[model samples]
Target: MWSAEDVARDSVRRQGDGLPLTAVGERVAEAAVREQEAAERALVGGTFSEYEAEPERVAGIWAAKHVEWRRVRDLMAQCSWSRYEPDRDVQGSEWARSRAERRQAVLSGHAADLVRRQDERDELRAELWLSAGPSRLIRVAADRADLRPVEVLAQLAERVVVGEDGRVSVPPFSPSR
Candidate 1:
């Protein structure tokens, strides 16, 4: 029986493993945008074939860019600060208030970026899982927020075989497998 803490830890591990892919995706999108922009510039300067043959490639680049942008937007939404204000009568001293405001400003500036990066990484992992799914069960399992890791494993699996000794088996499965 997997505890909630085990599930949470596994989720974190999975997210961490996929973090590098997010950076790679970001770089790929940036390079694609630069290439597209250069090609557009060449077209504007009277080069006919510069942008003629790569419409499909350009479309893919833009699609990836859009997906990444949407991920960032969703991350920002998740990180939105609560609309709570301190009571005027119970407010602390001016020095303390100033320090708090400074701390908040720093956090909003720096911590928000870190949160966005983390969110993007998680989104990338989810995207990869979704892309690998032809299975409706996996799709539905991926969407579930309340599932334990073991439950999620069972849900996404094609077949779950349990032995008489209570050990469960999940075969190696992927789109190509």
Candidate 2:
């Protein structure tokens, strides 16, 4: 069976956005709702535990996923509720509106942090996920330019076909078939 670390790494790759979206409770609640929706969409497995055997790894991955969902939920909530209706502006109301906008701007920055955090988590998840499953050698991007392909590929099998096997093959989900 694949380990939780593998799954966690795969998810990490998807999240490039920063994090720490915790703010007012109402926003938190709305965020939670959004999170549930996203999680529902993401459910290939019944629960994250389906990905791993170890209890601690499962817990860590779940907690990480939860944080990611919560951040997304709050970001959506902020976008939906931040603006006021047009054409109803008194001096006092205008001032309040401006204040609210400022608050949201600051909050948006916070949301960005949360997004970034999610990305961080995504990075971890992506790695874990990749390790747990099979992979094809797509393309290699290395920091050092002079090194030949052999340095990265290391094995003769990595040249053509990808996945756990050395032979060329297509992914099951690929639509070419």
Candidate 3:
């Protein structure tokens, strides 16, 4: 059984454009999604009790709520009067009303906390994506300098300066010939 930490980390790693992962990263990401899907199924079956404390279970619950949210949102988006709540047999303005009610129910209760956490996670992920560029640069530069990436990054941190005029002053790269 994949742990919650594994799912969360792999899920975050799978995000972002142009950030290619190693083969292992790819495998882990695929496994994480599969775990989430299994959790979702368990949630539907009321068999998720054993994993209630797991963060991955929460994420899976959020995923399930998201599916419902989308369906309700789509119903609200439709302009047709022919649209009806198939399950509730609601029609006309009542259909829209029913959708709104269902949307609130789907987004409320524990799901509201999940939404907040998801928002914070998204903000952090954005920051991580922004840093990925510089991290990649550090890796390439470190490789060329025959030094560890952390050493290269630390040297830059200590020596690289930003001027008031917005010019960057990097210590001269004197690669051994």
> Which tens-of-lDDT digit does each residue in 79-146 have in candidate 2?
56342222222332444456567668889999999999989986522122233223223223222433
lDDT of 3 at 60: 64
What local distance difference test score does each model get?
A: 0.46, 0.43, 0.51
Tell me the RMSD of model 3 versus the true structure: 22.5
The better-scoring model by lDDT among 1 and 3 is 3
Model 2 lDDT, full chain set:
0.43
Candidate ranking under TM-score, highest first, comes to 2, 3, 1
Specify the poorest-scoring 10-residue window by lDDT in model 3: 12-21
- Model 1 residue runs over 4 Å out of place are 1-96, 125-177
Give the distance in Å from residue 114's predicted Cα in candidate 1 to where it truly belongs.
0.5
Model 3 stretches astray by more than 4 angstroms: 1-130, 162-168, 174-177
TM-score of 1: 0.20
The sequence of per-residue lDDT tens digits that candidate 1 reaches over residues 10-122 is 32223323234354345446646754775565455543375473444444444444443334334434545132112311222233355557668877979889999889986
Candidate 2 colliding pairs, count: 42
Q: Candidate 1, which ten residues in sequence have the lowest lDDT sum? A: 83-92
